[model samples]
Target: MRALTHLRSLLGSILEKKGAAWPDKATIEPPKDKQFGDMACNVAMLTAGKLGMKPRDLAEVLKSELLAADPALSKVEVAGPGFLNVTFAPAFWQKTVEEVLEVKHCFGKFNLGRGRKVQVEFVSANPTGPLHIGHGRGAAVGDCVARILRAMDYEVSTEYYINDAGRQMRLLGESIWVRCLELLKKPVTYPEDWYKGEYIIDLARELLTLKGSALCDLPPAEGQDICYEYGMKSILDGIKKDLADFRVEHQVWFSEKSLVAAGAVERTLEDLKSRGLAYEDDGAAWMDTTRYGDDKNRVLRKSTGELTYFASDIAYHADKYARGFNTVVDIWGADHHGYVPRMKAAVQALGRDADDLKVILVQLVNLLRGGEQIAMSTRAGQFETLADVCAEVGVDAARFMFLSRKSDSHLDFDLDLVKQQSMDNPVYYVQYAHARICSLFAKAAERGVAMPECSPALLARLDTPEDLDLMRLMEQYPDTLANAAQTLSPHVVSFYLRELAGLLHRYYSANPVLAASDEDLMRARMLMLAAVAEVVRSGLELLGVSAPEKM
Candidate 1:
């Protein structure tokens, strides 16, 4: 919890004398190739350009300044190309681990955004059908974004913008109703492009029970719209159940129906007109988004007077801003990438800063069995569900697998890897490390051995190279959290878990924790173990995965 000691002073000496501020970012990067040092920074070199001094010379000055500020520095060498490779004393690294223990699973949860209100709208898949595998990826990524922002002390509202008023919803209702009429042995006409998924047939069954024979009297083709509406609701209910089974929750299910009913969509168009960002053109209402750096103009309403998707989006974003969110994030699939420019333009057209709204587009998820791709279509009810995935593997395995890759990258969801529950699985590896630690504690207790407190001076006992390596990683956790937030990549936390788990597994295998009763040694190592526990626990929590004390 202590401020980064000597590095701050060294940088301060250079900047304060020059009547400036210390560089806002002083990263403690592992030497790119690892031979440079445990931690390295180019602050001195970064400042050299501003200070009118050679970078090497600046590093030399900063080295002396650093040692003077804190004796924790074992060595500070100015490497080639003006890099400052820093070696901290063994005790310094050890104490970092102990701090992790003290903080428990709360380690690395930062308040970067303070208490600002933020809204994350993701996985707004139309209520017309169940979520497909692709939707699952967005669901996980979007949910994690909200989780991380909340962890960083932001008041985040996780919402789902249901497209209940769209063409898709209407089509869905028709599909289900047509299927129901077919089941009732009545004359029916199904649309060629109607939903063909078995879920539609299942939804028809639900409607049969809800409305019974009353639907039999309505003309088949005529009542299809009503049936479609009924089906959309039934499908949405099923979608909610699937998401619930996956442990994902939303604060709001803001419907497009609400937008249209409240006149918000029309009102937004008027708002744009008042700002001169909109105009009537060629049977279409166009937004001059190119003026604001978009690729071209966007249509808000068709010349036919029907509202366009862009129009609804404008109203949606306006509602977001009106709700007073400091930040608004939209998570959409990769195919929606083209929509980003105009959406941002819409926010700006509505007179809100584009920067206030952020959009994250997650790439597709290709479900694979063996090495071959698995074809899953929710409309066909042919794909796997998150609920099915959870039941097959587990909540932890499902979550970890979903989180193991970057959102912007395509993920191959492998049932074999997730179901095996082996060391090859990263989730099991981390969990096993945690379980191993628990076993160690159980054994230690059985031996009538008690863990001693880490004295303020006990860190000095941790003087091994491996011990120092673990500490170096510990110091980077805060940066890891910040980097993940800034990049909107939750997979970084996934990477961190594997890295820390590797360290702990290696340390446990090589060292004998019970070799001696040396209180200082035992206390130091135990504290490090506790710190490892805290980090793994905190990391799993971020992904909404549980870290069990037992495997």
Candidate 2:
């Protein structure tokens, strides 16, 4: 980081001295091949034309300026067209060990967000049935994104938009009512679209104990309404518990019904109408979404005087902005990808920038066991619930597996592999690396080999390729986390942890730490291992996965 900062400063100073306009940003990245250098910069190639100098000639000048500004740079070579590959003195890498040790678990945090107020809404599954494995993926992705943003110093508010006012809730109520009638041994007809989950029968039995058979005495509509309200609340309660168990706690549970009751939906429609963005056509209100890139105008209200689902969503988004959030992120199922443009258009019509509303479409999860796909259906209540999967593989494994890929890609969660205690299981591998480090330290203590204090002088003794590779990866943590937050994806965290763990395992097999006779080398290796362990723990924490000291 210091090297890049110094390079940027030197480039700007040299540009100003040459009476040339300096670029606002410069790309200074660590080279992929270690032989290239500790860091590489392409500022010269990028700005050569602007300065009217040949790329290599410009790079030579910047390289000289950078070396003069930072004596820690051992060498700077111009490679290819104009890339400046830089090598840092050994002391620079050594200093990073002490720095990471001093910071401990907070090593990967970056201030890139600058405290931007953002809200992340994910896994807002309706209060209709138990959350399945698909919802599990969204929960993990959304929660990790929120965690990464917070790590980047964003003021993030996590939310779950409770879709409590939709047709699903009505169906849930009717389902429960019919189940109740069945329990009462009364003749009843069931709708084909009604929920068929066994939980409805369970709910009916519970309702029997509370309301008894007296509910049957009321008019059918009244009884169903009573069931709808009670069923919605009960299912929502279950949903809350399931999320809490999965370590996903939302700061807000915004209810859709509340918007209708508070007249927010009507007010939003009125505001759009006042802006000439909404019009009535044949007794139905329409939004001019096509004006903002939608495929066609969308219906806001039907001729029957019923607001469309899109209408409620627009009002909800308006509420999100009114709550003072500068950015609002919605994590929806992958099936909703087509819904993105329409929602963005609605935000524009509401007088807010479309970019302020970001949507992440999470793909489905296919559960596999014994090399065969398991069938699932939420309506029939025969799907693998998130809670059940967690119970089988444990929370750490479940969270890690769900976040192991891009959210938009389908994940075939192999139950057998993740539950293994071998290298085949990534969660186990990473946690084992941490546990191995802890065990090594414990054994060292038993042998009266105390960990010496960290210092540049001792750490400089580490010169092997393995040692340098570990330090390089650890240093990339802040950048990797920033990328994850900027992209709104948590898969980066999982990938980083796995790579770091692989390096640690390789180092453990090749090096002799406590057994080494040289005191300085042993201390340096121990300090390095400790830093690696802390980094692994920190990365795991970001993914909401456990880093156990013991397997």
Candidate 3:
């Protein structure tokens, strides 16, 4: 701890003197390879260019400064060119780990969020249908963002902005109602534009059971409205249940229809107009989005005077900012990338900073079976719903797979790999690592062994590459969490878990936790194994995945 403390300060001082306004926040990241040293920094190289000096020379100076500052580093050496190689005293590793045990999973936590009130609005799919796989990824990403923000110490609010409005719901209702009548021997064919999904038929049956011929023999227009309500509610309820099983719960379900019914759209338009950010053009109201770097200005209200999704978004964001959130993050599908500029323009036009709104576009998922993509037809309801995938691979595996990839990258949710119960499945491997530790601990207890406190043997004990590798890996866990929180990428933790499990499995195979000699060594190694378990479980928990103690 003293070594790391001194090194951070020394580096900060050296960088400040190089005339580039102190590297306000520079992370002393662990180098990818241990042979390079316990930790490595490009800070010297970074500052060397700014200082107009050779990087190697700069590193030499910093090395001396670090050594003088903290002798406990064991050795501070420069490797390659300008790479600052830092070594922790063996005792330093032991003591710092005591801190890990004391702090538990709370280790490496920072005041990054500082309790700022931020809300994540995601999976606002219309209640017109069950959630499909695409919707599942968004839910996982959005929910994880909220989870990370909260863990980073923010006053986070997670919301589900229900798209309960729009013509789609009406069409859905009409489709279901007609499908109902069609099933009842009324033989009603849907309008050319009505929904053709099988869900419509089921909804129609439910409506018939409750309303009987009361809804039958009626005009499609009347039945459309009634059935739209019926189908929408049914679908919405179904979506909520599906999401809840995936561990997604909303602090609020902000309604799309309410923005219009409550007159927020008109009020927001007026607010924009008052700020000279909006105006009428060719019988349409346009927001000067070009000012905010949009390709062209956008229509807020159509020539017909109906508000577009943009207008509702403006109102929605207005409400988000009004709720006292200094920053608002919107996670959306990649197809909505073109919509980002206009939304930010709206946020700014409402007298708030456009930069305050961060829109993350997660690319679409390509659901696959065997090795080929499974093309889906939403119209005929041939697409796999989130619920369907859950039923096939289970909620845990489904959610874990969705969170494994960078949300920006198009993920292929391979039905085959997810169902695999072997090392091929990374989630299973990580969970098994946790479970293996439990098995080892149980084995120890069966032999009347108890966990040992830190001792001279445990202190001098960890010398194996696997052992040090695990320690160094554990050290990165906190910063890993902080960085994941910073980028809103919970997948980083997923990736880290794989590496952690890899280390655990390798260590288990290379060395035995229950040894012949040195009973204290067994206890010491087991204590480290416990640390591995705790870290893996903590990381998995943030992603809403299970850290199984028994597979």
C-alpha lDDT values of all predictions: 0.80, 0.89, 0.81
* Residue-wise C-alpha lDDT for candidate 2, range 381-481, written one tens digit per residue: 78999989999998889999999999999999999999999998888999999999999999999988888888878998987878888887887787788
Q: Candidate 3's residue-wise lDDT over 206-314, tens digit each?
A: 8889998778777768877888788878888898899898899888988889888999989988988888889999999999989988899998989987778888889
RMSD of each: 2.2, 1.6, 2.5
Q: Residues 129-165, candidate 1, lDDT per residue (tens digit)?
A: 7777677778878878778878888899999988988
TM for candidate 1 is: 0.94
For candidate 1, which ten residues in a row score worst on lDDT? 1-10
Which wins on TM-score, candidate 2 or candidate 3?
2
| Error at 160, model 3, angstroms | 0.9
Per-prediction TM-score to the true structure, in the order listed: 0.94, 0.97, 0.94
Candidate 2: which pairs clash?
none
Itemize residue pairs with steric clashes in candidate 3: 173-228
